[model samples]
Target: MAIIKCPECNHEISDKAPVCPCCGAPIADHVVTCPECGKVYFSNQTECPQCHHLTGKEVAAQADVHTKPTNVHKNNRIIIMVVVAVALVVCGICYAFYHNAQSDKEQIAYEAAMASQDADVLQNYLAMYPNAPEEHVDSIQSHLEMLKAIDRDWTNAMVSGSKSAIERYLAEHPNSPFKSTAQHMIDSIDWSVASAAGNVESLEAYIESHPDGDYVEEANDAIKNLNTTTVQPEDKLLVAGVFNSFFQSLNARDEEALTSTTSPLMTKFLGKSNATRSDVVTFMHKIYKNGVSTMKWQPMDDYKISKKDIGSQKIEYTVVFSAKQTVTHDDGSTEDLQYRVNAKVSPEGLISEFNMVKILE
Candidate 1:
């Protein structure tokens, strides 16, 4: 039996043995020797035990080719793993950057919409970013609803075209966006009504209520026109007599005479504290009882008489007079007074209302 080297471990073994004792490599029947070292081995043996070198010519060539390829495959696997890890890391960074950029974009759009204070802009922003911050979403929705409601109310008010309706809307929605427009409409309506009336009192009342009114110039012009109109002498005398009778009755301290000079309605309506005509007479009598011992009236040059229709077949006349009233008190104190008297006369030649105020010196 000749000695042989194991193919796997290069251990010496019998060539006749089917398997090597040290490496369990199956031995071929043919014997061989290492050409370089002269070590004996089987034909199937790829290496010599004595020299620790490959022995078979075909075996050495095959080993050389297979070993290099296996090593290359392992190195390639490691490189592939590293590349996969790096790619995963790069993908993660890109995803994070994209997510953050999208969030920032949404935030910026929301802020811009809020700044506009427009309902449409805010609605568009909500449509673009449904996942916007909770607080901002709720606030935008509320503001949009409010603006829509105001628009609805304002449009309804304009359609109504009534002064009271517009005024009611303004009172209800003090902070409405159309506040200025509503105010202008109210002024315009007032001006139109006052112009159509074509009366000095109505125009003067408008001017008083709206000092900075849009039709202030027109109102002044209307007043000037009315003032230029003339009054008849018979009408002036009739108005004057009503006032003279009222003052004379008041000075006389006779409740019966004073009450007789006034219409029953006028007697009842005089003196806010008096509930009945008798109460009004008693109240006036009390004022005059202790006051003047003697009173004299002299009419002045400035006097006005105007008539207005109260109802069908009923006319009311207003008399304005500047008069000198000299009063001698019971204590012997005499006062020379300048007085202004405004009196309203009924159609039946009775005084309907009397207002007396002392004119300042």
Candidate 2:
């Protein structure tokens, strides 16, 4: 070993020492002695600072060759360099293989999550692969949020059990995969309501609204039976037609046709006292003038008043109907409304008395 001075305390020490035993200073790495000034400094320096002496190549040439012949020293150094280089290459290969295996596993899990199309599975993937690529993480998060929103909307629809609620879901999620299911829910609900009413007009309304619905055939068959079936106390088919005509005329905004659907002796109209046909015509015309562009009856089914079934030439019936009207103004804006009415077609198949009912969803 060569003699050298400690950098911190200037005490002499062996080159192979780990620390300065005399001064207790830690030995620094890659240290060397300046031959000219006998000063010790790190091997990375090119010169001695105390005497301003520049170091020559002799310092490096003699650094590791002092104990052996020149040729053997050179060969030993070459072997050691080759060994260190090979160790570095092996380390790089091992690390690359480990990184690739991790990437493959992550890819497999991501593909499975996408295939399942499940929200929970995607959430787990995010928690597991926090260091995943930016694009993949963004796509997964977006899909998961959409799935959650769809579930929430579906839950609300089912809990409410209302056609409007179900329809709102469809409207909000136009491109949803549950499109067909939501539409079926609406169709089945309408069919059930029509069946419960058990009237020719209600079934007819269902057929008109959903021509391609699942219950179309059944509704048509029901209507055929009601047309031919003898309804007690009064002709149900004929009386329902009178109520239908009244709305049809009202939609057409034809005042004369609307007046014809009523009786000359019509004394009670829409809870109005001693209201005449003229008064009815005037009131309806006022609504039309206000901006009612179209009036549509939603679904109608009438119940015949069996207690008042006494006349031969005329029949009295209570009609419960729902309607919708659109109001459009000159400014190109529009409003839609739900309308309902409970009225009686007093003798002569004319609407003599009427009452407005609460609007429905």
Candidate 3:
């Protein structure tokens, strides 16, 4: 057997073989190149005796038919490729549209969540897009965490029932959802503390801190009560001191020192209205200026004190006292005087007014 080239693929093969192995082209005995047609064919046949078809022209015609089918198949493959490419482009466009629309909806929801003060709005938004691949996913998760932390801190603050705790909550979360309520609670705590103390300074401090607090009216009332209460032991001691100074100045018949023990603007003195401290000085001067040498006026232990009306921006008390006097006349005659005297003393330990209500002797 001799090696020969395949007719269709030009692969070397056995000449005695019935077909070429590479191209599977049919081979006949003595297959060789046809000189007239420049193609591979059986050399033993010039033409078919029965059909009388010439080998050179017939093989050439067969080659034309074979190449024609190959061209047709290539065109079909190109058309199928174009159709598939168009389908993929359309699918990509549809997917992009769907994702864009979903993104728009998520944006709207996110804005609403941000605007709302309610924690539930944020929670619902988180529930819908948890662990999503959207751009604002991290932002939503961060907001949810912040809200949770605020809620946790607020609950702790409320449970503790401490003013400092509430204050700390306000300091930490200034923009918290419970900000207003938290501040109000702190204000109430201050008022409660001040009220429990029951003092003017403490209540005044509360007023200074919260001018528009819920208890402002009540605070003012409490202050008024404290200022006006007449039976206070401390207040009584102050009034007694003022009475002593006034009597000491009177017994000496010293005009300036007597005026020093009285208010600058006295409303009454020696049974006169719209009186002045100068009026008291002049009255004391006239009592001892002549015919009375070494005159002495003394206050007795019997004292009655009551609340007088507030005047000249001071708390005034009406004090009634039994008084005694001794006058050594220039003529060497001695005289004894007894009087039930009434006076008004201010909280600043100063006398504002005085009168002899009754002559006891």
Candidate 4:
């Protein structure tokens, strides 16, 4: 029932009609009216037909409003990722700093322990840092063992209370830290031992062994006090020759020569087991018959003579010498013997006493 004006004929027509009746023009279902000019046009048109105004301006404004929020969201996501990355970097830096500080502390402690050069300190370090450097750990362990062994040896030497033991320890561990202490102990012990013996021979031996010893003056004083007697060089040679002649007679199995060189007391003492000198000669002959083939004696340079008075005008000289003997037995077996020969020589250059003692292997 509504009425509309037709554009071509300017005539009145029904609004619901499919065409305008006056001009016979078709009506469009998607028509719009331009407000500015009161003109009718298709709704899909870009501009108003009467005024040429753009129709999609509102849609563009709406699109701008929607797109702005999406861009802001994307920017916010990027900011959040950047913040997270920065936080991670800071945390890593802090961890690395802490780790390096801890490692430095450990290294300082290890070096301090090593500088101390104390076994207990090194042991504590090993216990604290089980992952220490391998070569360093091994060195610490080896040094500790050496210290322990040295301590043990030192204790044993002190306990033994012998000059020989301390000397042996010093000989074995010459580079030990306690070398000076051990040497001092040896000097003290040697002086004590020589003083206890209270003899010129012991003191002289001590002086010979320790020329620059701490007790050299004391030893010389002791020697001057104990001994005032001296043997002439010619008497020493005479006694030495008598000993040589006695042994030569024994090697030659000359019983008459042996009896002539031997003192009357020594011959009597030898025959104590028998009744007569013939029985003594028979005893010697039996000894020589067992396995004796040949005997040789080489004298050493350590000859000493002591003059002793035995209630006579004659002087008895006690002579001692170190000698080596090589004995060839009848069974083709040879024996090398190290022994000391002690003989008492009378004023007539005869052997008054004779004894042989084994010295060493």
Number of the top candidate by lDDT?
3
TM-score-superior candidate, 1 or 3: 3
Which pairs of residues collide in candidate 1? none
Model 3 reaches what TM-score against the true structure?
A: 0.49
| Residue-wise C-alpha lDDT for candidate 1, range 105-142, written one tens digit per residue | 98888788867647889989899889888988987888
User: Candidate 3 at residue 185, lDDT?
Assistant: 93
Expressed as tens digits, the lDDT of each residue in 1-361 for candidate 4 is: 5565655465766656776666554443433456677666544455675798666876345445545544564687688889999999999999999988877877887778767535788788789878777876887677778778988998999899887888899998887778888887887788888999988888998899789899999999877645434566776677777766666766777888766766655523332421344544665566555687987766776888898655554577787788877888999998888887776677777665556678875
Off by over 4 Å in 4: 1-63, 66-80, 111-117, 171-177, 193-361
Regarding lDDT, does 1 or 4 come out ahead?
1
Query: Candidate 2 on 1-361: residue-level lDDT in tens?
Result: 8888887678888888876787544454456666777788755445676775766786555434432443453576688889999999999999999999999999998888776557889999999999988888888888888888988888888899999998889989886667888888899999999989988889988988899999999998777655444354446675667777887887777789988888775657767767777887887777766554554544346343332444453445666666566667656677677667766777667877776755656
Q: Which stretches of candidate 3 lie over 4 Å from their true place?
A: 1-73, 93-119, 130-176, 196-198, 207-292, 298-326, 329-340, 344-353, 357-361
Highest TM-score among the candidates is held by which one?
3
Best-first order by lDDT: 3, 1, 2, 4
Q: TM-scores of all models?
A: 0.38, 0.38, 0.49, 0.35
Candidates' lDDT values, in order?
Answer: 0.74, 0.73, 0.78, 0.71
251: Cα error in model 2, Å: 48
